[model samples]
Target: MTDVSVYTDPQAAVPTAPLIETRKLTRHFRVGRGLSPKMLHAVDDVDITIDRQEIVALAGESGSGKSTIARLLAGVYTPTSGEIYFQGRAVSSMRSRRDQLAYRGDVPMVFQDPFSSLNPAFRVSHGILRSLKLHQPELTRTQRNEEAERVIEAVGLAPASDLMYRYPYELSGGQRQRIGFAQALAHKPKLILADEPVSMLDVSIRIGLLNLMAELRRSAGVSFLYITHDIASARYVADRLLIMYAGHIVESGPTEAVLANPKHPYTDLLLGAVPDPRAPLSVAVEGDTGEPPKVIDPTPGCRFRWRCPLVVDECHHVTPTLRLLGDGHEAACHVAEPDAGMHATKP
Candidate 1:
């Protein structure tokens, strides 16, 4: 595999509004219909953004609302409240079929499992061709075929002519995953919501895929919302990192800065969990064994207080909001002080 390191064009101009932005986005699910129906807060009051040609990693453990956010951005699930703005336009305001189709084409999704994302019965080019047909209906049959081959080759699958005719089961896992990217690329999207695209592959294969993403970003000017539980991979490919805990964004900042000085206890716990094979192991941090709370009709308070070692009185009654902690860093915690690093204590 080529070097996994990504090159950033430092001189690239920033856009007026972000490529995509969410304002207090929230999605809830009603479970067990009865006299009293309960609301499961899948995502709650989350605000996030992805700039043009930028890669933002939403990193967290399973059930942290990472995938839910990706789905919301992809328009698979409607938000119970809040608004999604793409290029400063509210998504909900797009009433026409043309506008809806345009939005879907501009914001394609790549699911976690490449196998399920592709149809085993059809040839590998099926998805790419279909996406082209939807987004570029003006193109003729020959043009669609050419476009499909172009995207397949763009994802590093050389000799797209031969590869496009092959079945999904015939290709290796990495190749199949690349085809998934090809499908997204075929849409000519501005931002791709990649939901753990590399988690199913081997470590060596994962690097190649990561490099492909970097190459695509460099060559195509496409922004990505990369969702994953793997922080190390996120650090390798993402310019910015947002850490979510129990359906809320706990911390967010530049990837290196967030890892170097995690202000939130949950962020610290996630970092501590990643084992370093080179270093000798020591006792685990206190509060590492606790489980995340189930978000069924949750009470109003800081969600992490149950497992937080630095819990304070304010954390139990009042929910914490993300406060700026300098250097573009923000954390949603009552006890974490600005510039205090992760060693913050309760008064």
Candidate 2:
């Protein structure tokens, strides 16, 4: 039961097409004090396709490598091995820094921390002007300023003129986030990678920001790759949701379908862990945070076996593949048949 409801837009005018694709992508890092340090398989083998004008959320617990995947797709880090394709052509094959720059203008990222990305010393106008000059330098001084102010207003930084000289510290969290968004949208980028864009904002402001993003998608056809740890919020904003665990997508498909009829044990645990108003403090997640499992050089079986309650001896011997079960829904589990019944009751 692939929940395709969140993605089906009757208003979209163009035939659906994939804008970005990654094949067998992988990234590994070596971390530790010893000269011969332990390797961290931050991003294991992953294949993904993002369609034009569609927002697909990458949701998982922190450190599941969702951020790594975001960085990889945005060209921030080249994949250790595998191919990255944008609009059918390969990224690594592209020659010349100018061509790369052109491609980047079409694909920009909005970071999680507004402070980390925005300089504290510069005024809001100065920040936007710098990006405009870098990406659209042909504009005259007046043209660039006008364009900057127009975009500022478009992203809902009200009294856009009034905020022109304000520094990062002068603005509220929500207002600062709006500026980051305005800068990203200034390029008129076709694809936007938002890494937890709303996590730092207040809950009320989060909805307003989300509503703005939704409007942008429908009006401008800007596809979003939203990375976040909030499942319910993902359901609200994403057309499709990819659930990642231990650097692997254990389950993925439409948000409603995957959330309602979760097939993987990890998915169930994740949803159960969501903060529910009905349960309040009783909604627990994995007992305690404790130390996460060390998956580098892990055995070939289920990486989640350390936490999966339904795990059996066979689960530790053979790794599960991301097999398509029905419709568009897919899962990497031994018992993921579409018609199979739930193995046990809720925790």
Candidate 3:
């Protein structure tokens, strides 16, 4: 089942301010065996907003462009087209050294693998202190040491004194993640673009880190743009959810609402397919069961049409722009179930 058009009384505009906004944000890469390679649309005309102190989960499987968006937001890969604004300031035109440094300082990224992210040769203290030295270089040596101790302890690295001497290999995966958090929190970033931050950790420890993140959000006002394919994790930490498919966002809204009633066919497939003990698991939606198509100057239409179970003829001929429903909810699907509540609204 598919659904669209999610407004009954059509609510008012949200009062909150968007911490980050990307208008027609796009990224393309040349990939081919020959010169003049064909462009692969890593991310296409995607528009989404993140609010201050809110966790926006960008959920999707691999090649779904979720991680690409996270990397783009983190200032790793420059966008081939479009602009990103942080607190109403445009980042595209600003290339000054000061601007770049400030951008990196304010927005830090946490990768999936904590072990690789940290230097194997250096002590755990070295990995966390490097960020402080670069960003807060004005601090005295004594002050920097104090800062490291403070952040590590705050991250619940109890007896933080003992952990500093350990190397990456010495610490457990959960401890490594805490050190990563310590690094990010040292700067007190406005936004942390976490690309599957806890995907590699043992299931038992994943919840602990997620809980720490949630507590950080509540206490420190740190906004998170967490990227993951796990809906259960998304439900655990996210206030909002953005479901992406084939370099495009199909639907997004308040987490509980979108999870309870996913609007797009792809989202429905995602929701129904997730492991749920509360509801009986159903057969996964089947169509063209594989990756997305070639994206060089792609023909204008819904990109999910190929695999979408309810894809209609209109989907191929017309590109559906995301339409706002109410209270920060939006989707870009063409054919939604008539009982939109079952697919787009909260229970």
Candidate 4:
């Protein structure tokens, strides 16, 4: 078995090195059937890091390239440019089959769709047991079944024997989702890239899954890159937050701090849309007015400029770089003041 030293101690002092880091990671797809094909900037020059035992929530609306980032991290889609590093080792440079397999074993993904992620032909235990076979080939059949049952119970599926034989079709949406968590847990991975794992489940069940993930992080010393559009849930579970818009991370900071005082206009707009019980019923909701800009052949400026209420001439000319606003807080907006105040600008 590969020694996963990175996830050894949960209570130990935080390590300076990042477990997973991406430097200017970008992925582009060529579309249109012509000599001059357009380029879709699915992920554009984004930098992110996930430290050991940390839950970083990547929140963005649909088509904001959140899932693409998750896929890139999971080694599903190769990046067109830039780099991904796992435990300080460059992922692109891992040539040996052993090293590649070790990396995959250490970085399992919990996909969004519980219904389709598992095959209908096989029982729940078969899926997890198959993973155990590949990762732990030395284990005997009895040991493997015991480990499978333990993992199924760990994911909150009680009476593991009953669930072990059931097909994907027989389980409820929540049960299938728990089985998804169990499959990822079976690998004993250091990092889990959960891409909207609870969006399809009932609202009541979402908290249960999130709690299970938190428990895994605490007990097993696992790191998570949680991708979702739901800000409320993100705030509840994440320690830090990254708000993405039009393929760019516009704002990032401590979850509570960012929620209480957002620096970027886009972030403010998102917070405004969230229902507040204290606010009057007649309170007008401010939202993004226009459609998102075309990622294909994108203009050389801030992507949110077209829909921004505080648009200015400078926004149309120069792309705003992500700059530090305060302690650990960053924003990529020209008019965002350091203290979360809006800078007046000409339209």
User: Could you tell me every candidate's TM-score relative to the true structure?
Assistant: 0.93, 0.90, 0.88, 0.93
Instruction: Give the candidates in order of lDDT, highest first.
Output: 1, 4, 2, 3
After aligning candidate 3 to the native by TM-score, how far in Å is the CA of 71 from where it should be?
1.2
Which tens-of-lDDT digit does each residue in 102-184 have in candidate 4? Answer: 77878889999999999999998888999899888999999999889888887788788889998999999889988887888
Best by TM-score: 1
- Which candidate comes out best when scored by lDDT? 1
The sequence of per-residue lDDT tens digits that candidate 3 reaches over residues 211-265 is: 8888777766788999999999999999999998878888889998887766776
RMSD of 4: 3.8
Q: In model 1, how large is the Cα lDDT of residue 334?
A: 85
Q: Which stretches of model 4 miss by more than 4 angstroms? A: 1-16, 277-284, 341-347
Query: Per-residue error at 327 for model 2, in Å?
Result: 1.3
Tens-place lDDT per residue, model 2, 1-347, is 11111223342233443688888889988778666777788888888888988899999888899999989888899889888888777888767888687668778888998767788878988878988898888999999988788778877776777887788899888888888878877777778899999988879889977876787787667889999998878999899999999888888888888888888878887776777787768556552232365567666888887766676788879988898876788999986678452333333
TM-score, structure 3 vs. true: 0.88
Q: How accurate is candidate 3 locally (lDDT)?
A: 0.79
lDDT of 1 at 339: 82
Residue by residue across 153-269, what tens digits does model 1's lDDT show? Answer: 888897889999999999998999999989988887789899999999999899998888888888887899999999999999999999998899999999998998999998998
Clashes of 2: 0
Which regions of candidate 3 are displaced past 4 Å? 1-17, 33-36, 278-297, 337-339, 342-347
| Local distance difference test, each candidate | 0.87, 0.80, 0.79, 0.85
Cα-based RMSD of the predictions, in order?
4.0, 5.4, 8.0, 3.8
* Candidate 1 positional error at 217, Å: 1.0
